[model samples]
Target: MRDRLRATLALVVVGLLAAACSTGGGDKGFTGTRLETPYQAADIALTDTSGLPFSLVEDTDKPLTLVFFGYTHCPDFCPLVLNNIAAGINMLDDDESAKVDVVLVTTDPTRDDEKAMRAYLDGYNKSFIGLTGDLDTVIEVGEPLHVYVNDGKKLPSGGYDLGGHSTFTLGLDDSAEAVALWNQETSAKEFAADIRTLLTDD
Candidate 1:
């Protein structure tokens, strides 16, 4: 099931990218893929790293929000994406950085309780917000964004592998609508560039 969802997502991304390219996306001046129809940010309440109720649209004060869905145990993509975003934000001026918010909603809530989520996110950027709650709630929140989340294959060590999930970082505007999508392969430089463009447009 997870594999099928991932394949479907890949195809969708390819189609979006192709459409953007054919339309001369250069006019947008964004390094990330601009969504033809933006997704309204989910307003559901979830527990933040601080163990307090948080609403993505209400709690975030920034004009631009970058949200990602991944688990702490993800062996590769999660850390890499977080690190790149952190680095990208660091490239901006103090005022510019302050205008953006980074959010990570864990896909593996079974192990990513409030405390664990906070600790893992601090390793990349202390300012980044980490959120975790019931797995069902997580899936519900991700639905509008086309983010796939599911338990992974069990392992022999009495543990399990990282869960399957989407790797795109969604860029949401102050209106709580996702305006762009950054893939895992996007470099820190590209992130910085797109962030600047988004901020300027906002």
Candidate 2:
């Protein structure tokens, strides 16, 4: 299965370059995982910070939809990834940057209530959208993307234990399909460049 997926992704990358070149240049590659076969957006929906229904489909108009799954209480990677995204957005031209949507979904939904989630993401960028709801919904939304979310154990203190989750960011194309992925090690500049390519590419 893994090998097949990789092979499919190789084809996806080639198609993207060929398709993108017709629109413009310098969009032939990216610093992230460019799949040969695009990932179809799943049918999962969750509650946004504003208590409204939220899904990647809602941001399909945007050239790119970046999704990350982690808990608000996460000690390191979560905040770092969000910060990288914010920095990446800053690297884009105003109009191109505006066309990107960053969505962070809570793996620990039980503890990451709307208020907490909003506050946490707001610290990174006011434009960031935070989503939280039942754990099952979160899992369903992340499953297709290979984002695992484990509800953490309880601790002696009122706080919960650290949770385990995938740390890669899934990048969705204009039609709301995931076509690329970037890990925590990816820099803001790299992400911004890839996003710009997606926007300008046909």
Residues 122-169 of candidate 1 have per-residue lDDT tens digits of 998899999888877877887776675643344343223333336779
Provide the lDDT at 96 for model 1: 96
lDDT of each prediction vs. the true structure? Answer: 0.78, 0.73
Superposed model 2: Cα runs more than 4 Å off: 1-29, 150-165
Task: Quote the lDDT for 147 in model 1.
Answer: 70
lDDT of 2 by residue, 1-202 (tens): 7544644564455345434423233435677766656767776779889988887776456778898887788787788888899999988888887888898888777788889989998899888889888877877777766554532344343333323325678888877778877767778888888887767766
